[model samples]
Target: MIRGLYTAASGLVAEMARTDVISNNLANVNTSGFKKDRAIFRAFPEMNIHRIGDPAVLSPKDKIDPKPFIGVLGTGSMLDEINTNFSQGSIKNTSNPLDLALTGEGFFEVQTPGGVRYTRDGSFTRNQQGYLVTGDGHYVLGLNGPIQLPDGKDISINRRGEVFSDGSFVDRLLVAAFADQRQLLKEGDNLYVSNQQPLPSNSEVIQGALEGSNVNPISEMVDLITAFRAYEASQRVVKANDDTLGKAVNDIARL
Candidate 1:
């Protein structure tokens, strides 16, 4: 009964974790450049079951025999990992010059207080210092360095990420792509950090637009329902085991 309780509790934990991921995805459905996370589960190792002859039924002179293999007993399961889905989201025109979007796999490098980080969000605005910055005020890095743009008027950014003012050249945007984005870890605020070296990006930038979040509300809602049902099932199993254990401790012990 104790083992059953533990096993059933593991299911509850796994389902709770899955629910957390689903809720997070749903919450970020309208967030720009947001990526959804996927929860993966793994089953515990199975134990082989075999039949053993009753010792009391065997004679002292006769050796006990082992019966044929019965089956396998499952212990439990757990949440293995939560992998972030980096699929591209739809780009929408915002009509703001600082707004940008990536058409392919790439990230915009920015200089933050916590060092440097990468993000797919291009909803940028100029800071008080006339430097192009993200919504969070992180400096938008350029090939030269932090891009300090001229006055807001007559500014244009090309698909090649080249900045121009009155047809005059300005610093190019620092668009970076990682060799393996799986190594990147989310650091919150729609930014990712990685130790891997960046590669030249083939992605094109679209100015006056922003990327939408990749989360699907309907799919996430379905998953949330499934997780809740799994959690309820586990709860029932736990209650059943508890009742059995109580019966064993009270009635069976008195027998």
Candidate 2:
């Protein structure tokens, strides 16, 4: 009875973790360059079931017979890990020169207070200092350093990440990629950080466009409902075990 209670409780905890991931995905459905996270589950080890007080173990004649095997009992399940889906998001045209979108696998390098962070968000603007920066005011890095645009100059970014101002070549955008995308960890502000060395990206940079989040609201809603139902089922199992234990301790003890 106690084992059942613990098993059900483990299930509840796993379902709650899954619910959190799904809720986050739903909330970031419209966030630019946002990726969705999936919760993976692992089952606890199975317990072998043996018949108690078997007659084969006691009697000499029955000693020749094999012990009876009942079956295996499942303990419960647990949350394994959260994985990010790095699929490309839909692109939307904004007709703004600073707005960029990647057509392939890559990330725009940004210089943050912590260190160099990478992001897919292309919604960029020129700061008061005439330096190109992300929406969070982080400096957008170029091939050499932070990209700066001269005041009152027309700007354009080509497919190869080259910046042109007033029909003059200025600097190239620092686009990067990772060999193992799983190593990249989210550091908030739609940015990812990884210890692995970055590779030069061959991805095309589409100017005047922005990438939307890849989260599908309908699928996330379905997952949300499924997790809620599973949580409720585990809660009921815990309650049932409590009632069974109460009867065995109080009601049966009275007799």
Candidate 3:
């Protein structure tokens, strides 16, 4: 009964973790370039149950009875990891000259206060110094370095991510990618950090647009309900175990 209680409690804890992931996804439903997280779970190793009792029940000097395997008993479950879905999000046309959207796999490289970081958010603008930067003022990087746009009323970006101001070529946008995308880690502010160096991406850029978040609200709501129900079931199991333990002490012990 005690082991069963612990198993049920483990399930309850796993469900709580799942709920937290779902809640975060729902909150970021409207966030630009946001990706939803998935909660992975794993079960503890199972123990083999025998019909004749444990083989260690007898001393080494004494003869032991044969122990036939009956079944396997699960210990508990736990939340393993939270994996981010890197699939592309839907695009929205902002019609702003500085706005950009990626049609395939890629991220924009920006020089932040904490060194370099990558992001899918393309809501960029020109700073007072005429340097292309993110909404947070991080300098957008080019092939050479931080791009410094020339002063011009006409600013344009092509499908190849090349920038042109006043009909004069300036520089190309630094769309970066990694060999192993799974190595990328979220660094908040819609930014990501990777241990590997950035590589050339095949993504095509679309000016005057931005990518929306990839969160699916309806699916997340359904998962939330399922997690709540599972938690309730685990809670009931824990309560039942506690009640049985109480009866064993208060009633069964007296008998």
Candidate 4:
């Protein structure tokens, strides 16, 4: 009975974790360059049950009597790590000269206060210092350093991430990729940080374009309903166990 109570409790905890992930995904459904997260679960290992203090149970080789194999009992399930899906999102054309998007796997390097961060969001603009920066005003890094645009000059970014001002080559966009994308950790504001050395990305730069979040609202709603139902079922199990314990302690003891 205690084990059953523990199992039901674990179900509640796991469902809560799943709900958190789904909620976060739904919240970021409209966020640009956002990637959806998935919650992974694992089951506890099953243990073998045997009859105690029985000679036949200990000695199964004896033909006179044989030990019986009992059914397995499940302890509970646990919530594992949450994995981010790095799949490409839909590209949207805004006709804004500063807006940019990547056509393949890679991230744009930005200089933040903390350190260098990476992002897929390409909505950039020129700051007061004539330096190219992201929407949040973080400096966008280039091959040499921060990209600077001359005032009153038309800007053009080519497919190969080369920036040109009045048809004069300025700098190359520092787009980078990692061998293992899973090593990248998420920071707030759609930024990512990683310890792995970056590799040259083969992605093409699309000017005046931005990427949309890859989250599917319909599927996330379905998952939310399922998680709520599972949590309710676990609550019922816990209530049932409590009632059983109450009956045993009060009613049966009085009898």
In terms of TM-score, the best-performing candidate is: 2
In angstroms, how far off is 218's CA in candidate 4? Answer: 0.8
C-alpha displacement of 56 in model 3, angstroms? 14
Q: How do all models score by TM-score?
A: 0.94, 0.96, 0.91, 0.92
The clash numbers for all candidates, in the given order, read: 0, 0, 0, 0
- Please report how far candidate 3 places residue 129 from its true position, in Å: 2.6
Candidate 3 lDDT, 1-83, residue by residue in tens: 99999999999999999999999999999888888999999999999987765565476687555786779999999999989
Residues 57-163, candidate 2, lDDT per residue (tens digit)? 55655563345678999999998888999999999999999999997889999999999999999999999999999999999999879999988989989999999
Go through the candidates in order and give each one's C-alpha lDDT.
0.91, 0.94, 0.92, 0.93
Q: lDDT tens digits, residues 146-237, model 1?
A: 99988856779998899988889989998899888888999999999999989999889998999999999999999999999999999999
Better of 2 and 3 by TM-score: 2
What's the alpha carbon RMSD for model 3? 3.4
Stronger candidate by lDDT (2 vs 4): 2
- Model 2 score (lDDT): 0.94
For residue 52, give model 4's deviation from the true position in Å: 5.5
User: Residue 231 of model 2: what lDDT?
Assistant: 97
Number of the top-ranking candidate, with lDDT as the measure = 2
Clashing residue pairs for model 4: none
Question: Which candidate do you rate higher for TM-score, 3 or 4?
Answer: 4
